[model samples]
Each structure stands twice: as C-alpha cells, then as structure tokens.
Target: MNASSPIGIFDSGIGGLTVAHAVTRLLPNENIIYFGDTAHLPYGDKSSAAIQAYSIKICNVLLQQKCKVILIACNSASAAAYELVKEYVGSKAKVINVIDPVIDYIDHHYRGKTVGLIGTKQTVNSNIYRKKTDALGKDIVLKSLATPLLAPMIEEGFFNNNISESIIYQYLANEELSGIEALILGCTHYPLIKSQIDSFYKENITILDTSEIVAAALKKYLSQSSLLNNLNAYIRHFYVSDYTQSFERSTQIFFGEQIRLEHYPLWE
Candidate 1:
C-alpha cells in the first residue's frame, strides 16, 4: 500500500505489455510486475466464469508480490472480472481496468457522438461499453464489432504488412462500424497493429489509444492518492504463466524492448 510497492498488471497474454510499456515510460521510477496468462490466452473465447476464476488467481499472485495497485490490462478480463477482482482485492491494493478510463474520456469529449468499437468476441458480446455509456444517460451511440481475428493475429506477429492490412481493412470496412466519429481499440493487442489501422482510415477517423489513456488514468490516481514514487531507480519484472519462444520474442513488439520473461506457472 506504499508508493514504493510495484504496480501489478495482468492480461491473458503479451498484449498487456503495451500498457506495461506505457506505464514504464510515464512513470520510470515506479516498479512494475506484469503477468501474462499465456497458458490460457485469448480469454476472448473463454466463458465469463472461467475469466473470473483466472482473474482472481492472477490477482492472488500479484497480491503475494505486494503490488500496491493491480490493473486488469485485458479488455475481456476487464469486462468479465473487474468487479469480482476489486471485491476480492478489497483493501489490499487499488484495482484499475482498461475500459473505464476510455469510457470516461468519451463521456467528457464525445457526448452525442456515434462511436465505434472493435474488440474480441468476449468483450463485444459483454456489451460493457454500451451498457456503461447507456448508464451515463448521454446521447452517445456505440456500435461494437467483435474483431476476433485481430488479437490472435497480432500475437502471432502478423502486422505492418499486406496480410495484416487486408484483415484490418476488411474489419474496418464492415457496415457495422461505418459512420462513426471515432473508433476504440477495445483490445490491448490492437495497439500493435494500430499503425495499419491508422493507415486504413488515413486519419479521417480518430483511433483511440487505450494504453495511453489508461496510463494517464493510473498516473492521475497515484498522484491524487499520494502514491506516486519519487525514487530514481526501479526494477521491472515480467512473468508468464506458461512460456514459449514466440511469446518471449513477441515482447519486443508489445513492450518496445527485448525484456526477459520469468516463467511462473499458476496451474502448478
């Protein structure tokens, strides 16, 4: 519960590294402990009960590490397990999810606008963003599409090329996402292919960068709570429940560097 304690972040896979990298860049003095549940990735396809169970387990691991704050960095987990984890963590640590910050941003800036969202099946089907916006009682219209292929494709290192562009274009071209003022990259993995997506729209439509928005929200919370670290040196730890060379190598794509990953299996 102190400023020096590391910030905990977890996702179904390396996609969460995008948020981890943003946090590191924004708060270099603060320590970070990131966990990727590579053993059961693409949580987009898993049941809500299963996502809740896995999220609680991951939070337990982060709590054991004495994390001062825990972030559900995956959209699927945020949609399915945020409330459960917050209740389970209780007073042990602060809990933040990737969805709320973006929602808040939209509420403040895009009221009465038609916004589009593209995410995994789990996130889109959950209708979290739609429900949250509706609760605001604003004139916001949200159109959501389940871009299930994008996340897995990014994890496999398929982006910044013709193959990736074609898929990106195909998804963006869908009638469901048309006529929107902006598009939300609802999945963290989508940021890896953000440039391709950006090129697809040619900057005509705004593409929300969820990681940066979430990072700013984290900074604001720490500053307001007096939990901001002032130290000059800090350590960053990356852990995965299960590991493969591909996951290890893909760290650079998500994290902006070739950081070492420690294998820490939750099932064992």
Candidate 2:
C-alpha cells in the first residue's frame, strides 16, 4: 500500500461529506476519494438488500480509485453493508464504519449516561447504537427520533432558517430531547444543524458527532498498519453517482470549494 494512496469514503448521499471534512481536518496532508450515491438519496428508506448492493457498487469504485482505506460514513450504509465490505475487501484494505467509534467513545469517555439518538428511520430501527451502548455495561437509555426530514434539509442548506428549526421541533415533538445530557447526531447530516440543535437543548448537552472520532480511528489504524499517507503528497477526488449543479453549489457548506465533479452510474 502506498502511503500516499487516498482514503475512500462513501455515503448514500452528500451527507458523507461531513465524514470527509473530519478526515481532512484530522489528516490534512492525506488525499481523499469520496463517492456519493445521490441517485438513491435516502438510504434510510431502502431495504437491507438494496443498501448492500449499493454499498458494494461504491466500494468497487473506491477500489478502482486505489484507495488505501475505505470509510463507510453513512449510517444506513454502515449498518447494512460494513460487514459485507469488510468481508469483500478482506486482508487488503481497511474498512471502518461510524458505529464502533461511537460505542468506544461512550464506553471510555462518557462512562454511563442516557443517549438521545436523532437519525434516519433505518438507523433507529437497526438498534445498532442501542445494543452497542448497552453491551458496554453502561446504563444508557436509548431514545431515538427518526428525523428523516434532516437529510434533505441540510442538503438544501436550510439549517440556519426557522423552517429547519420547526422541522426539528416537529420531529422531537413527542420525545424529550431536552433531558438527555448526551445526544448523538447519528446522521452525518445532523452536524450541519448542530448549532440549532444546541440552541434548542442549551450548552450543557454533550453532543456526540462521530465524524471526528471515526476519522481519528481511521488515522490510528492507518498509522499502526503502516498505511498513513506519505508526508510529501496530497490529493482529493469527488465523485457522485449523479451530477447536479446544486450539488456543486451545496458542497461549499461541506467541501469549502467546488472541485470538478465526476459521475458514475451506480445503483443502476
């Protein structure tokens, strides 16, 4: 594995850009190759087999890109397909998902506290976070609100507006988001509304957004496995399964600047 090889990260849609941002902040000198399967924007609504098939398609693209490691940055993709990718990518490249890092963080740092989950319907249904948090012997209460509206809300850059806040309030209407000392922004897109979420809950709530944690975990694994990028070379690649002018415009919130966009016929 070349130290300079780029890391591959994929999401069902543009939300994985959150993960890409963290990787950039954590390993500024390393290259990244990101793929967004935007044709199927919300993985939360798809069945398990559909997610598995879609994940493998993006994984193949990453392999073609010669990525040194792949990050399954989307929660639904991670939940339904990380094991499949790990099995397929076996012994060659590293693959890490967003789940374990959150578990590890809660176990090691948080110790014991109830966690509030705000994610897509699929993630909450899978019970991945709830089971993992409980497995660590932490007396954590799992309260989840499937905020499906958030994906398109952030994608459309609506986080700063009152409409987005109204959506958040509507999503958590029956659930008590005010009480949890710890909140998990289970979707990559949720961090875009972190300030608004914070404003609603106040400052003392410890929000856990795993983009940083996952990036740190990937960095540690790359270092120990001797796959860290070479100090001298850096690069970034952006690929979308479907191209849109709006994508390039919205990417500034995530990617800072629009690099050229490439399209691949994935999930076809």
Candidate 3:
C-alpha cells in the first residue's frame, strides 16, 4: 500500500506476461512480482472452486512478497476469482481484474454497437463480460464464443506459424463472431497472436486488447492513491508454481527477453 512496494500480477500461465510488459512500459520506476500458475495451465477448463483456490495461493505469495497491489491478468481467473480475492485482500492490498477495465472501455467507446468476444470456456461460461457490459445500459450487444484452443496453442509457442494461422482462422470464422463492430481479445494470450486475428478481418473491426487497458488502469490507480514510485527503483521478478523450458520460451515471446524464473512451487 506504499509507493515503493512492488505490484503483483498472476495468470494461469505465461499469457499474463503481456500484462506485465505493459505495466513495465507504463510505470518504468515501479517494481513487479509476477506469478504464473504453470502447474495449473489452461485454467479455462478448471472448476470455479479450483481457480479460486489457485488464485488465493498466488495472491498470498504476492502478499508475502509485500506487494501493494494485485492484478488478476488471466480472464478465466478474473472471472472465477476476482471478488473472492478482493474480499480476501481487504485493505491489505488493492486488487484489479482484467474484466472491469475492458467493460468500462466498451461502455465508453462502443455503446450501441455489436461487439464480439472470444475467450476460454470458463470466461464465456461465466458470462461476466456480457453481464457487466449489458448492465451498463449502453445498448451494447455482446456475442461471445469459447476459444479453448488458442490459449494452449499460444502457450506452446505456436504463434506466427501456419499451425497458429489455421487455428486462428477456424476460431474467427465461426458464425457466432461474425459482423461485429469490434472484437474483444478476451484472453490475455490473444494479444500474442493479435496480428493473425487482425489479418482475418482486414481492419474491418476494432480488436480490443486488454494488456494496454489494464496497464493504463494500474497506472491510474497508483497515481490516484498517491503510490507512484518516482525513484530509479524498478525491479522485475518472475515466479511460477512449476517450471519448464517451454514456459521460459513463452515468457521470452511475451516479454521479448528471457527472464530468469524462480520456481515457487506452491503445492509442494
């Protein structure tokens, strides 16, 4: 809750690094402690209770590291665990979820327009994006499709390849996502293949990526709370519940550099 404390961010896997990169760019002086639940990759298929349990453990690890704020960077985790984590953290730390900021963005910018969303099964099943956006009374029409394959594909370093392109085409070609004014890249991993998705529509639709939105939101939150760090104190730390060379590789893909990941095996 102070200016010098590190910001915490966690995701099911390396997808959240996209958010981490954005945060680093936006607040160059602030430190970050990132946790990737590599042990529980593809949280989109897990039960609500399981996701919450994993999220709480990750949040506690961040708290133990003296983080002042926690960002749930995974869409599935945000949908399943945000409220519980918010309540658990209480006043110990501030909590931010990826969904709210994107919903707010749509409410402000795309009102009265049909917006398409593609995400993991848990995210689409939770219906959080649709419910929140619709409740805004902005006359926003939401059409969502569960994109269960993209996350794992991105995690496995399938981006910028023909295998990735074919998968992206299959998902976007679905009739459910057709003819929308905009498409929400509802998973953090989606940004990694943004060009492939963007190529599908040929600039016919606005592709909303939450990495920048969430980063801007964190910057604003820190500024409003008078917790902006002005010193040359930026430090980056990456942790994972489990480790593999693939996770290391994907981390490089997202962050554009190899970060030495410390294994913080939560269940062991």
Clashes of each: 0, 1, 0
Q: Candidate 3 regions off by >4 Å?
A: none
- TM-score between candidate 3 and the true structure: 0.98
Q: Where is the poorest 10-residue window by lDDT in model 3?
A: 244-253
What's each prediction's TM-score? 0.99, 0.95, 0.98
Model 2 worst lDDT window (10 residues): 172-181
The sequence of per-residue lDDT tens digits that candidate 2 reaches over residues 94-155 is 88999888888778767656778888888888888878888888677777777788987788
Query: Order the candidates by lDDT, highest first — what do you get?
Result: 1, 3, 2
Residue 211, model 3, lDDT: 96
Q: Note the Cα lDDT for every prediction shown.
A: 0.94, 0.83, 0.92
RMSD, model 2, all Cα superposed? 1.5
Clashing pairs in 3: none
- Cα lDDT tens digits, model 3, 156-199, are 88889999999899989999987799999999999999888889
Per-residue lDDT tens digits for candidate 1, residues 1-268, read 9999999999999899999988999999999999999999989999999999999999999999999999999999999999999999999999999999999999998999999999999999999999999998889999999999999998899888899899989999999998999999999999888888888889899999999999999999999999999999898999999988877988986787888999999878
